[model samples]
Target: MANALPLVALLVLAGSAALASATTFTVGDSQGWTTGVNYNSWASSKSFAVGDTLVFNYETKAHTVTEVTKSGYDTCSEANKLSDDDSGSTTVTLATPGTHYFICNIPGHCSSGMKFAITVSATRSGGTGTSAGAPRVPAMASVVVAAAAGAAFIKLALL
Candidate 1:
């Protein structure tokens, strides 16, 4: 019983640390997923790692986020896109370490500078922390952490 408090505290802290490690980057940073913004250049300024996320915000019907292979990206071809979305907001997690390509396949859109490539490296030893201002702990996780803390306190008091 005496050892439980430290264990619970450690669990809660570990969860928080995991959350802190991941980053959610908003593509184009206010300019959003639209034309005229240099997406590849935009990506160059940051370091991408597996587990990081890219968020594309745009008009619902105006553009589409098309994930494609290297060839597809080079040709701006929509024939074999890996994924496609036009939901005004798209969130994509970097699941693996490699260069991923994205383009807005709306005819001239891709040719007219509406595409970018991001390179994701394997996760680093230490977490980069949530630099994009995403919440570290979810609401449910917070509740659980609070309950565990309270129980630990009660146990310590009893001891």
Candidate 2:
């Protein structure tokens, strides 16, 4: 029964670590979303994860942020867009781990270097674990705690 106390404490710590806050990235930084800005360089400087968000600040009428598929992004096509936003200040949540593509749908904006692609890593913890964009320690620790607590409960029951 006493051993169970330490296991519970471990569980609490694991839960806290897993609940770390998500990061918010301002797309294009101080330059804001506009033509002539080097989006590829900006995107390469940061690592994106699933709970993170991309905040696009631009002029509503002058530009638009459009999410497109890989093929569309490759060709700079706006014909079949996955999602489009023209609110000038749009926020896109990274809910999945994969390559996401974005472009300005203005007539020649994408061709004028207004497109960027970001590849979200599988795990934010930066390890060889298989958690996929999530912290691995908390998950592994939770499993250990559960097993230890279960064994302790069984031992108490047998007593």
Candidate 3:
């Protein structure tokens, strides 16, 4: 019985840690923007963590989730790339644990509030943590709302 006590305690602790660390965030198109949600703009609760995947749902207008850094923080900007807008949606896996700056590269959209921020937390769990977040992901039954009609697709050269 004495040996079993210690083993049981270890198992309990491991389970608690897993419960606390597992999480996922489902990001979708913005509603306010006539151009639709340009970048990492979700419904609300603008925050996220590592091991989480940002699901960019499609709309009639094509948009991209372009990772970037602030004007003075150029280091992060170096490794950033633009995800192609196919299937009207896609998912970008958050690999590193840090503040990810993103914006819509669609013409003047970024300047028009088509930008947002996501914080990726670094919890020790097989590199990529489980997808978890508040306001949980939406059900599959709902249709994605696209940008207002006549919003032309803007093309820009990525950095």
**Predicted model with the maximum lDDT:** 1
Q: What are the lDDT scores of the predictions, listed in order?
A: 0.82, 0.79, 0.49
Q: Kindly report which residue stretches of model 3 are placed more than 4 angstroms away from their true locations once superposed.
A: 1-21, 28-47, 72-87, 124-159
Clashing pairs in 1: none
Off by over 4 Å in 2: 1-21, 126-159
| Candidate scoring better on lDDT of 1 and 3 | 1
Whole-structure CA lDDT of model 3: 0.49
Residue lDDT tens for model 1, 55-142: 8999997999999999999999978899999999999988999899999999899999899998888874544533366533445577
Candidate 1: 10-residue stretch with minimal lDDT? 129-138
In model 2, what lDDT does residue 119 have? Answer: 91
Winner on TM-score (1 vs 3): 1
lDDT for each residue of candidate 3 in 9-40, tens digit (9 for 90 to 100): 56555654554443455554334323544444
Best candidate, TM-score: 1
Instruction: List model 2 lDDT by residue over 1-159, tens digit each.
Output: 667667667776665664454566788888889998999998886777776678899988789999999888988997889899898999898889999999998889998899999998655655321212332233456666676778778888879
Work out the TM-score per prediction: 0.79, 0.68, 0.48
- State candidate 2's TM-score: 0.68
Give the better candidate number (2 or 3) by TM-score. Answer: 2
